[model samples]
Target: MQYLNGKFQIGYSIRKNDEEFVYNNGFLYSYSDDPEGINEWHNYKGKKVSSLVDPYEIFFYEPADVVPGKVKITASPFWTVTKRGDIHFMMNNVEGSDKAKNVHSYKKASDSEFTHTTEFPGGELRSVGNDLYLISLENDRPVIRKAEGGTNDWTVM
Candidate 1:
């Protein structure tokens, strides 16, 4: 650590084999020897293998916006994808409150926005197989409930 001008600066040193190191504008960067993996693939006999299709052709990507404009996701969402391709999400909107509400919602794979369901007390959601479960606090004790299908309606388990 060093005090330069009026600010304190920290420094670090790292050593790794087959890594190129660079320091510029108070920033450090390290890169592998084969950064782009031009010779990556290998056969069973440790010989370079050739494929009919290139890596980019084998794995194509096209980015798209998934979130809806009207929806505001304020908290960490507990989400799961069902066997039928429906997406279920449970989130608590209350920030730093003891009486937070856990709101449940879902959206079909073809739908653009999610449909809100009845809200329940604060809890964490867990999905097992095609079943959904919730673990909440009741009188400071752990209480468990299973969701009825993909809706918020729950049955105490």
Candidate 2:
């Protein structure tokens, strides 16, 4: 099955032992799946490949909208496609927490560069150059820096 969300498109196939799902964001294609379900899922379809499978039945949510920069699909918690379809934000839940989370939040910066953010407490995530940065308030003061490379790698002037 194939689904288009702005600049990103998703293709998926379910098989008995090896299922594959791929997401295309203009510049690159990313994929995931389980190998065990490939054959079983493939066999049912036989030679018919063009037939539309009911995505609504398999997914948790219905597609609310599809446009150049956005697509909303019904999933466990709902999902939004952004950046001409380069980004996909899926609603999720944190383990042992009552609040819902947004997983799979990715944005394409270019044909070769993409970024994603995971929500945390009292902070915002962003990308600067090739690094991921976080800005948060510490002791009522704004603390800004690269999140992964090293401490003090970034400073507020």
Question: Against the true structure, whose lDDT is highest?
Answer: 1
Off by over 4 Å in 1: 1-75, 95-100, 108-113
Residue-wise C-alpha lDDT for candidate 2, range 15-133, written one tens digit per residue: 21112111211111222122322222211112222223543222222112112223222233222233233333333322212233333334443333234333433234444334445
Alpha-carbon local distance difference test for all models: 0.42, 0.31
Off by over 4 Å in 2: 1-8, 11-77, 96-101, 109-113, 120-157
Reference-based lDDT, residue 86, model 1: 47
lDDT of 1 by residue, 1-157 (tens): 2222222222222222222212211111111123343434432122333541333212111111122222222444455555544456555542221332445566554555456644566477666656678888888889999864456667888
- Model 1 lDDT at residue 117: 47
